[model samples]
Target: MVMSANERLFYHVLIRILFVAVIAGSLISLLAEQFWVAELFTHFRLYYLLLQALLVLIFLHTGRHTLMALTILFAMPNAWVAGPYLIPVYGGQRATAKAATSIDIVALNVNYRNDGFARVAGYLRERDPDIIVIAEYTPAWRDELEFLRKSHPYQFGEVRPDPWGLAVFSRLPFMESELIDLADTDTVHARFVFAAGMMSLEVFAVHLLPPKSAVWARNRNLQLENLVDQLGASTHQRIVIGDLNLTPFSPYFSRFIERTGLQDARRVDGFHVTWPVSVFPVWIPIDHALADPEVNITSVHAGPDVGSDHFPLEIRVSKGVNKQPGQVRAVFE
Candidate 1:
C-alpha cells in the first residue's frame, strides 16, 4: 500500500519516541538509588498510571503511531510495580525444609540524630529478635543499644560519626567479627558465626552507601559487586541482613542479586516499605535482607517504628531442600 507523507512521518516519530523512552528508562534505572531521583520515581510509578490514561487520550485524538509505541513502552513500570514483591528466581534449588524453628532478625537504619533511643530499645526488646542490625548508629545510639547486650550477647559493629556506623547484636555468640571496610566509607560489612545442625553458619550484615550522584552510584555498585563476589565464594549458609539502602528494582540491586545468587527476603511476599516514618506515604523498600540459595526463607516483614527515619526489617530463614526442583512453594501453602 502506498503510504501518505503524514503517515510516514507518524511512523518515524513513533520509533524515535520509543527509542528515547528506552534510553530514559535505562538512565532512570541507573539512578534509582539517588534519593531525589528515587523519590521521584516512587511517586512517578503512581502518576505514570495516570500518564498512561492521558496517552490513550492522545492516541484517540492523533491516532499517531508514536503514541501507540510510547503507550506500549510504558509497560516498563511493571517492573517497578512488581519489583518490590517479586519471588526469587532461584533456578534449580528448592528449599525443602520448613521453618521448624524461626529466628527473628531485624535491620534498622536509625537516623543519627534520633532522640528515641529508649523507644527503639524498647521496641527491639519487645520483639526479642534473634539478631539485630542498626546502621547510621552514633555514639549515643550505641550507648543506648548497649543495654540489649544482656539478652543478645553476641555483638559486632562499630559506632561511627554521622551517616555510616553499624552494629549487630545476636542471641548466638559471635565466633567471628570483622569490619570488611570494602574500600567504601559508608559501609560496614561483617560475618557472624552461629551453630546450626552440628556445623557453624555465618551471617553477614551490610549497609551499602546510598547512591546519589553518578559517581557515587557507580562506586556503590562496584562496592556491592565486590561484596557479593566475596560472599558468593564463602562456604557458609549465608543470611545477609541490613539496611542496604537500595531497592529491588534498581539495576545495582539486580546486579547484586545476579552476582551473589542470593534471594530477596520479600521475593515470595510483598514489598515492605521502611523509611521516613515521620512522613506518612513516604514509603520505599530501602532496608533489605538477602539470603543465599541454600537458605530457606520463611517470612519477611517490616517492624513497628522505633523513632528512626527508617523502619526495621525482620526475616526468618532455615536450611532445607525444596519440595520440587526449581519450584518456589508458598511457606504457608
Candidate 2:
C-alpha cells in the first residue's frame, strides 16, 4: 500500500494537532490546580496519568519521538503528585510491639438511598470498631443502626434526610462533644477522656459538600479552611475522619494537611480507593483519616462495600506519648 503526498500531509497535520492538544491540556492541568476553575480537574489526577500513558503508547507506535518526549516531560508533574500515593513509602517505622492502649475507628458514607442496612450492620459487628462515623445518615439509617447502641452507648450528631447528615457512635464515653456549623455545613467534634490508663483523644466526623460546580467547590474549600482553623486551635491529639469528598491529590487536600499539620493515614497505608465501588478502575479515594502528629497510626485499611457508593475506612491508632493533663474542655452544644 502506498499513500499519495496529500494523504501523507493530512496524516502529519493530524498528528501535529493531537500532539499540541495533549501538550496544552497537560500543561494546563498541572498549573491550573491553584485556580478555583481549574481545581476541579485535580480530582482526576489519576485519570490524567492514565491518559498520558495511553498517549505515550500512541506516540511510540506512530514514531513521534518529539511528541513522545514532550508528553513524557509534561506527565512528570502529575506523576510527581501521584507518586507518594501509588508507592508505599509513607508507612512509618514498624512497631516492634503493639502499644498498650489503642483506639479503632470506622468511617463510612452510607448512601442515603442504599437499603443494604443488614450488610452494613453485619460489617460493623465483624469489625467491632470503638468509634463509628457515618455520613449521609438519614432517618432510615438511624433506625437500621439502632442495634449499635448495645455496643456504642455514646452517640453524637443528628440524622437528617440531606446527604450532609453526619453521626458518630463511640463505645467510650465522651468528655465533651460539640457540633459546629462551618460554611453552612454541620461538623461534629468530640473529646474522649478515657479511664485512668487510656489516653484522651479528640475526634471529628465531617462531611464536606461535593464540588459539583464552581460555587460548590468554593464552598467546600471554605468549609475545609474553617475546619483546618478549628483543628489548628485544638490542643488534644486528634483523629479526623469522614467522606471528605476530595482525593489526596487535590491541591486543597494538600493545603488542608499542610495548614493543619495532620498526617494522612492513607500515606502510611496503601492507597485504598473507596468511591463508586460499582466501578472497577474508575474509583477514587474520597474518604480519608487524618491524624494529628501525636497519634500513631498503627494500621489503616478499607472495608468491604456495604451497598454504598463509598467503602468504609478502618483505622487503628495509639497514643504517641504518655498521657498528659487534659486541655480546657470545649463546650458541647
Candidate 3:
C-alpha cells in the first residue's frame, strides 16, 4: 500500500527531529565531559519522554527500518534520564553561609585554549580566595600567575611543559605536593595543606581525563574512587576540587560523593554551567567544588569568563571546630 504524501512528509520530519535531538544531546555529553544534557533537559525530561513516545506513530507508519532507527535515536536522550537525572536534582546541593568561622575556596578549569591569563589572574586576585585550584594550565600561564604570589604566597604544581597542566595556589602553606598520574598522559593532580590552629587540611586538585570511551570512563571513576578512599582514610579535613570531567549525574560522580562523603556546593539550589563561555547567559555548571563534611561551605558562585571555554567557580568554606587535630576521625564513614 502506498502512503499519502502528507503522512510521508510528517514521518520524515519526525525522524529528522529525533535524529537531531539525539546528536545534540550526545554532543553535549561529549564536549562538556559532564552530565550537561541531563541538566539541560532536567525540567523537560518528562516532555521529551512523552515526545519520544509520540514518535511511535511516525515509527509505525514509516516501516520497520525507520522504526528501529527512530527508536535508537530517541533512546539516547532518555538514557541520560537513567541514573544521572537523579544527581543534579538530588546530589549537587548549593550550600548557604550560616556562620562566621567559615573559610573560602574556589575551583576553576580555565580552558587551556584561552589566552587571557591576565584576566583570570586578576579575577582570582580580586576574589581573594583562601585556596584556588586550576586545571588545564600551560607554561605560558605561569608568567601571568606571578601576581598571585603577592597574596597566595604559597603555591605548588609544575608548569606542564606540555599542553595539559594542573596547579594549585593558596594563602595557606603546604606540608607536601605530589603529582597523581592515573595512567593518563597528563600531569593533572596536586595535593597541599591548609592550616588553621592545631589542624591542617589537605586538599587534592584533580582534573580527570576526558571520558570519551567506556574504558576511559570506568578508569576515571576508579582513579577518583582511589583518591576518595585515600582522603577518607586521612585524619585531616579534606577537600577535592577542580574539573572532575564528570557531573553529579554520572555513576562515577555519585560513587565519589558516596565514597568520600563530600557534598557538592551547588546541589542545594541549582546547577551551574562553566563551559563555552562565548555562549554567555546560556551556560551549565561543569566545574565543581566538593568538600568533606568537616569543611563548612559558605557559598559558591560562577565568576565572569576569562576568554576560556570554562568559567571560574568561586566558593567560600570554613573549617569546623570538629576539624581540629585531636578530632582525627575517618573523613567518610
lDDT of all predictions: 0.67, 0.75, 0.64
lDDT digits (tens) for residues 1-333 of candidate 3? 898999989977877787567545544543333553343433233344445555655556657566657565755655564434345555455556434466667777776667887788778877777777777777777777777778887787766755458878777777766777754544568877667555677777877765666666657666776686678666676777777776565545656676666767554334566665774454445577776655655566677876677778777665554343222234356
Model 1 weakest 10-residue run by lDDT: 324-333
Q: Write the per-residue lDDT of candidate 1 for residues 1-333, one digit (tens) a residue.
A: 999999989986885575455445544644555544553354334334344555556666777767556665664564455434533433223333335465567888888988888888888878777788888878999888777778888787888877778888888776677777765655667777776544556777877777666666566667777777667567666677776766665556676776666677676446567766865564777777777555666677777877888888877655443333243312210
RMSD of 2: 5.7
Positional deviation of residue 333's Cα in model 3 after best superposition, in angstroms: 10
Q: Please report the candidate that would top lDDT against the real structure.
A: 2
TM-score of each predicted structure versus truth: 0.74, 0.81, 0.68
Q: All predictions: root-mean-square deviation over Cα? A: 8.6, 5.7, 7.6
Candidate 1: give the clashing pairs.
14-66, 94-322, 95-321, 95-322, 96-320, 96-321, 96-322, 97-320
* Candidate that would win on TM-score: 2
Off by over 4 Å in 2: 1-25, 31-37, 50-63, 89-100, 186-198, 320-333
Q: Once superposed on the true structure, which residue ranges of model 3 sit more than 4 Å away at CA?
A: 1-100, 183-186, 196-199, 280-283, 321-333
lDDT of 3 at 132: 77
Better of 1 and 2 by TM-score: 2
- Rank candidates, lDDT, best first: 2, 1, 3
